[model samples]
Target: MTIDTQSQRAEHSPLRRIFGSVFAILQTRLELIGIELAEEKDRLLGVLFLGLDAMMLATMALIALTALVAIAFWDTYRWQSLAGITVVYAIAALVCALKARNGLVNSPIVFEATLAEFEKDREIFRKP
Candidate 1:
């Protein structure tokens, strides 16, 4: 029996070439998108951590400053020192409370982006 290599190659050459090209493009696109998403996730986490660290440092600084000021005023008028410390604490607490509230407000934006990504992945997979 003669092997019909020429006929088989002719029938499949164009289709196989086109399919290989399409698959290569799709794979490249998927890899690029994954890398971008990873970078974005890293950046988001870094920002969140920085914000948290700043808030913590600010809180500590406020407390330390108030204590120092209170000690300085303690010999003159204990009431004045106590009042100053109280005001400092109040202001710091108010700021921290507002920041906590803002964090809650910003969470929805993050959730929306996450949900959108999930939807896109779902759609991609659902497509034949």
Candidate 2:
């Protein structure tokens, strides 16, 4: 009679099983987090755009009022000084807008995290 040496198989170590379960949970959580982040990013972009539009409309209103007021007080204070102040305000607004634009274009942590989540999900689903 031959010995049934091949009948028994080694079980996965407890540590290995725990690690695998932890990894799977972490990956699933990360994917959920990524989707949330993407949604948040979209929301942020929408708010930013709305704010920019409002700012532009307000600036235009202010400029029109300034023009009317300057015309009314043309004989008292120099129009040149009023124009100079408007120029300064415009410059400041420009600088702030540029900084905001830069922040939007450069920050990619949200997108990166979303991409990583997608990759993990893909790997998980691809397994046969």
| lDDT scores in order | 0.77, 0.77
Q: Top model by TM-score, which number?
A: 2
Give the per-residue lDDT of model 1 (tens digit) for 21-110: 768756765666677688779988999999899979988997788778778887888788788678867897799799989987876443
- Model 1 residue 77 CA deviation in Å: 12
List the candidates' TM-scores in order: 0.49, 0.52
Off by over 4 Å in 2: 1-10, 13-16, 80-128
Global lDDT of model 2: 0.77
What value of lDDT does candidate 1 attain over all alpha carbons?
0.77
Model 2 root mean square deviation, Cα atoms: 7.8
Model 1: clashing residue pairs? none
